[model samples]
Target: MNVETQKVKIFMQKHDNQKRALISILQDIQAEFNYLPKEALQDVAKTLEIPLIHIIGVATFYRSFSLEPRGKHQATVCTGTACHVRGGPKILDEFERKLGVEAGHTTEDRQFTLETVACLGCCAIGPVVVVDNEYFAHTSIREVGSILKKYRKKEKDNE
Candidate 1:
């Protein structure tokens, strides 16, 4: 069988092919592949005896699920009203310039994906940036280079 089918089998085995665990199964698949492959989705439909449309609906309905591949590092800039007034747009532009990818897109090297959020709920710390799981509060354009450098360094070190 194809690799996608094999992967689906493994994830199905993990969840015992229970229909109730569809979301959990999809999560495991996404965690393994960064995004859900179409073939895997088909396998899931067949394995769980669920309608393909239902599976597609659930996957598309969830913002956490990505139909496209994501980068190794996820960088989110808050563009809420508070953050907007605090130079958030400038910070996002700086990231786009430095990373060579616009917001909502990943770098060609797949090292970083830049995204903007309506709010991170840390309005007091306007213009916040969350890279991976680390938060950088009160960020400024001048600090963008250093912040990206730190992540790049970490990536290199891990390599």
Candidate 2:
């Protein structure tokens, strides 16, 4: 409906007019829009000669893709066996409370995406939380709030 949304559709069209390329095109659109806009998905379906329902199905099926718009910062807490044993769940809970969103959800303001990763392969950093891909090892309830502030765009105090 808006100009940017229209541009999203046009970009999805440029990838190639193939229905099978939906997943990759959707990923590209998400990379540009910060999340998959519903309008963009519809456009991809229309331009690629694919069924809109099928596109929706693919988008919903993948955990790596989100149907809703995501925040600028993504906060992922490791939930691997090692991390879980080391209080990862509690750390995740703290993040949920502080950010006002549960894992697998984004903040209403779209400033943060809270998530849990099965493993980050950082076993030694078991209780790790990553903010925008920067690892924070040995995380604690006392440490999460301060760590979050560092990634926030509005954090003058953190600066």
Identify the candidate with maximal TM-score: 1
Tens digits of per-residue lDDT for model 1 on 10-129? 989998899999999999999999988888898899989999999999999986788778899999999999999999999999999999998988899988989999998989988899
- Give the alpha-carbon lDDT of every model: 0.91, 0.84
lDDT of 1 at 12: 94
Residue-pair clash count for candidate 2: 0
Prediction-by-prediction clash tally: 0, 0
Winning candidate number (lDDT): 1
Off by over 4 Å in 2: 153-159
User: What TM-score would every model get versus the actual structure?
Assistant: 0.91, 0.89
Q: Which regions of candidate 1 are displaced past 4 Å?
A: 2-4
Candidate 1 positional error at 137, Å: 0.8
